[model samples]
Target: MFEILLALLAGIAAGALNAVGGGGTFVALPALVALGLTPVTANALSRIALVPGALAGAWVCRREIGPVGPTSMRELTAVSVVGGGVGAGLLLVLPASSFDAAAPWLLAFATVVLAFGRRVSQALSDRLGRSVALSSRALLTGQFFIAVYGGYFGGAVGVMMLALWGIGLGLDSAAGNPMRIAQLAAIFASATVLFLVASDALSAPLLLGAMLVGAVAGGYGGAHLARRLPAPLLRGVLLTTAVTTTVLYFLRG
Candidate 1:
């Protein structure tokens, strides 16, 4: 009962974070690992559990989502879906020990991005003296790789997407947020389908159920709350979570 309650709370935090800024994996993945799932299993289960949350967020932001730069929404989403499935396939094929070894480094890399990605995007934009939009090919290529990463680990994938748009098209993070959430839903949904069909994530029905229910509530509420929250405050809280989670992962190593 306590574990179920903990998973529920973690899911709420993770879902809210993903809706607002995209560090949910840092929360969800760790909580599952601590609950005795292997890192790879935890990753698969968390991704599966979070799909509804991502979808909820996307639904809430549907009206605000638009084409990103020169890329049509249809094209971008297609690429994301394909790339995410490919990545999830890799996860299932790879040895579980490999994921365990790589988990800490993945968390660290994601933390660095969560901390500095926006600043780096701004600095590059300033250096260019104008927004330098990527060709459609370039944008899709970048998104494919990010989606692959999202399917595999997905710590701060949404922030990575926003940073990509910010540098390439000079899109404001706020304006790009709806699209980020939508794409995240695309990535997670694809990954979840693959996971459900091939992985052992369904083995832990109780934990998954608790988290899924909590995430549904969190994602919907968080989407509404995001419009009213200060961006700086949200970012600060995400950064803190990212840092703390990353440090603990490293120490656990």
Candidate 2:
């Protein structure tokens, strides 16, 4: 019962984080693993539980969803769906041990990116004397790879996307957030379908259900709340989550 409650709370925090800035997996994944699921199964189940919440957040921000410069949302979403499916397939085929070993380093890298991505983007833009914008094809290709990662592990993929778009197309994080949530939904939705059909993600029905419910509530409310937050505060919460989660993972190792 206690573990179940923990899962519920974790889901709420994760969903809220993703809605605001994207670091939900850092909470949701570790929470499941601590509950005794294997790393691969935890990853699969987290994706399953978080999809609806992502969509809820996306819906709240639907009016704010906008273009990524040259790349239309339609094209990016198509690539995300296909790439997410492929990445989910890979997770099922690969060894679980591999994922367990790689998890900490992946989280660390993502933490660093989430922490400094925007600043780095601005730095590069200043260095070049203009914001670098990718062609439509290039942008789509980059999104494909990120979506693939999103399906496979999905910690800070939204932040990564924001960083990429900010660097490549000079997109503002706040303005691009709605579309980020939407694309995250698309990626997780495709991945969830594959996991439901192919993986043991449904083994813990109660745990999944609890988290799912909590996430939906969190995502819906967080989206609206995020609109009122100052950008720096949002980034601070994201970074703090990332750092704390990364430290916990390393300690567990």
Candidate 3:
């Protein structure tokens, strides 16, 4: 019971951090493992919780996301869905222990990006404001890869999506937020289905339920704050969280 509450609280904090900064799982993932889940189970369950939060974030940014046009959104979302499903399938079939052993290094890399992600995002938005300009192929390729990574492991996925959108999609923050949210949703949606269908009942139901509630709340909060706060400040917070989480993870090592 205490562990469930801890997970719920950790999720809420992560959601709040992600809502404002991005990558709250840096906080939640390790905590879940500490509470007794295997690393892969913790990572997979994190995706389950992420769905509602992504939806909440997208809903909050709906008006801003409108400028991207229905056609583009529909098309991009379809690609993301397919890519995400494939990635999730990969996770289901592969031995996560090998990946799990290497996860800390991946998290470390993600932490590096978290520090400068927003600044890089702003720069990409400004410099390339040049739209991949009807290059359907580039868009498809980049989005698919991002979706796969998003499904496989998500800590650094946002940074990756930013790069894909910035270069291939030539997107600005307004369009990017909703699109990214939708893409992330697809990623988790696929992973969640995979878990529901294949893996033995891996996570504790109580922990899953708590994370769901916390993620929903945190997602709403993060989305709302993304606009209210200055981008640089948000970036700074994200960077700090990434570094802190990395340090904590290493401490356990």
* Candidate whose lDDT is highest: 1
Whose TM-score is greatest here?
1
What does candidate 1's lDDT look like per residue over 1-253, in tens digits? 9999989998898888999989999999999999999898899999988989989999999999999999999999999999899889889999999999999999999999998999999999888756467899999999999999998889899999998988888889999999999999999999999999999998899999999988888888889989999999999999999999889988987
Model 1 segments more than 4 A misplaced: none
TM-score order of candidates, top first: 1, 2, 3
Better TM-score candidate (1, 3): 1
How high is the CA lDDT of each candidate model?
0.92, 0.90, 0.73
The TM-score values for the models, in the order shown, are: 0.98, 0.97, 0.88
- Which regions of candidate 2 deviate over 4 angstroms? none
lDDT of 3 by residue, 168-214 (tens): 45666545666666667767777788877775434488888898898
- Give candidate 3's error at residue 55 in angstroms: 1.2
* Model 1, CA-based lDDT: 0.92
Whichever of 1 and 2 has more TM-score, that candidate is 1
Q: What are the runs in model 3 whose C-alpha is more than 4 Å off? A: 66-71, 118-134
Report RMSD for candidate 1: 0.8
Clashing pairs in 1: none
Residue range with the least summed lDDT across 10 consecutive positions in model 2: 124-133
